[model samples]
Target: MKKTFLAFVVIVILLSCKQKTGIVFPAQWQNDTLQQTAKAKANIVNNLAIDNTYQFDSTAIVSGCGMVALQKISKDYRYELIIELILDSIPKYKQFSIVDFRDHIKITLNQYSKDNKLINDICTDTPVYSKDQKEPITFTAIEGLMTITNIDGKHSPFKISLTTNNLVFQNADKETFLLPKEEFKDVLVGWYAG
Candidate 1:
């Protein structure tokens, strides 16, 4: 009887140890306090408007491959705007219209709604989207201006003003979306290995 009781106690201890070591959560995922603080600092002010009808706040900035991309999503996650600018060198105060860099710039607007379940994906250029897709619908920016200022380093604050107009979507049924203007001031910039 003494031997049997000892064996039972040993089995219970092993089972408890196994359960405790089953799942391990990463240290970063355990708390999001740092992430929230970082996000608030990155997007100090984000005001985006399209055709004076749709308005959104700036979300985040992601950078890679000599380019910095600004993203804005609606509160409902129904609309997303991505503007990618390729920069070879840091410009303290550079201003250019959309027509100036037809190939170097990419502007994509995605709409997700119940009516259009798939997604209404449109862009000013195609190269940024994919290199394998045979055909992609491209848009034309008739008039627009973008300015970047106060770029010091990877973590320094910067400002960007983007105003676009008359984005013509080329598809079976051509549609035109009006100006999408956004201004971001004193926003922090960062880079990761992504």
Candidate 2:
């Protein structure tokens, strides 16, 4: 009886361990915390239209190739954004530094169909030289259906797309209804989960 009990306990323990490992996600899972954070940071440009109060660090710039790390405050519930500033400092030419001339700031929004086909893409030229330089870009949301598409991949069966007539961006001399910083966190949380 004692031996039988011990064996049973071992079996149960082993099964539990296997279950935990099965649920453990690899480092690159799309919905994983890291991916979510990167998505959230990238989504910051969208958030900017909602809230202008939230300011990003000059070092939080994104590059064509870079590392983005994310942390989940709640499981698929809330998240924090952290960015490792990697500026491309390579010399493009003998006279000018590549990093110095790169577009330092950019704001953009995009929508796609369920087929992974891009429907619309809008972006503002990011200003690099002056902090006070105003961006004349704006985004407006249109009322419509948004669809996500399945691209060739072994990952999640669905990608994200947006459709709405409400989104809009325009230049404002003072704080306007379209530009508020308080909506940043909530907008991100919704987009991250949606």
Candidate 3:
């Protein structure tokens, strides 16, 4: 009789205890923190306009037989604008130096798009230099939408065309040459994720 009572208690205990359906989520998967971060990053992209601090650094250039890096920085982002003029078919004479007798093209970019009712676009400044570069020759935007000419350099206005992903170099005459965008995936807006 005692044995029978003990068995009954054991069954009752098993029935009373519930089995846990465990599905553990890691810390990174936490929704609250993720939502907050996403919201912040979105705002950064939206409000990205040209900053006064954006300037070209001649020291940050990287050049080789088939590669050239035009580095630009602002309070918002850092980019490597490349102009691949010489193709592989021809031997590299300038070591990818095609712009203004320099290894890489001279360009400074603001981290944000311009604030001319088009905060969604990116602003670029091409530092055109002649015999002397006391001041930048021209301030060229990405879409040719805005052009700022400097009296120090020539008035040749060029534009960046992304429709076919073509980067063109023009003087007073339009479409004089095409500088291919070889590699520019490295875009870092320091405030956001790397």
Candidate 4:
């Protein structure tokens, strides 16, 4: 009985040897999924303001690596963007991605501006990139307070701030700067709720 059972198992294995079973994903498919999810998140994020909806754009993911996007949200049409990334994985001792740009929106608050009031106006300094570009699309500070108010008076106000550095580079030894090759790096990290 043992011999017969072993022989049956061997025959079954041999019969199934030629059967190929594997999972193969499309090129950039994961990246595409990440982008899709990001876009969905952006849709919700864009509608955050009661009076103003933020306009989100994708900059760079990783200079020849991953995916990224930019979110611009503000009151009075004040321009601010945040960078997001979706990568296969970060290699050992490697930078994720980078975006560079030369546009910024400054915040000028009213006289009654308090710490809470300034939260909405503050945004993380982020970079923007394009296919044919090398430097950032917007150059601005990322670690500060921002106050976003409802221009339509239908929504309340809110604030946001980044207390740490959140910029990602291409790799170690390369100066932490933005590059326009891999993915978009322009995004809105967070906003206030009011």
lDDT of 3: 0.30
Please write out the lDDT profile of model 1 over residues 1-194, one tens digit for every residue. Answer: 99999999998887787688753335545556678867654432222122222445555332222236665555554555566766553233666666667676776655555332222222123334333323323333334566665455653233344444433222233443443455545433334332
Model 3 earns a TM-score of: 0.19
**What digit string (tens of lDDT, one per residue) describes model 2 on residues 1-194?**
99999999998887798688764444436558877787656534434423332222323222211121111111221111221112233221133221243342122222112233111111113423434333223322211111111112222322211111222233334222231211111011111221
lDDT at 28 for candidate 2? 39
The whole-model lDDT of each prediction reads 0.48, 0.28, 0.30, 0.29
Error of 2 at 78 (Å): 34
lDDT of 4 by residue, 59-118 (tens): 312111113223333333223344332212322123322222212322111111121112
Candidate 2: where is the Cα deviation over 4 Å? Answer: 1-16, 19-21, 25-31, 46-194
Can you list the residue pairs that collide in candidate 1?
Answer: none
lDDT of 2 at 142: 16
Q: Arrange candidates, best TM-score first.
A: 1, 3, 2, 4
Better of 1 and 2 by TM-score: 1
Top TM-score hit? 1
**Candidate 4: Cα lDDT at 148:** 21
Q: What RMSD does model 3 have?
A: 17.9
The candidate with the higher TM-score, 1 or 3, is: 1
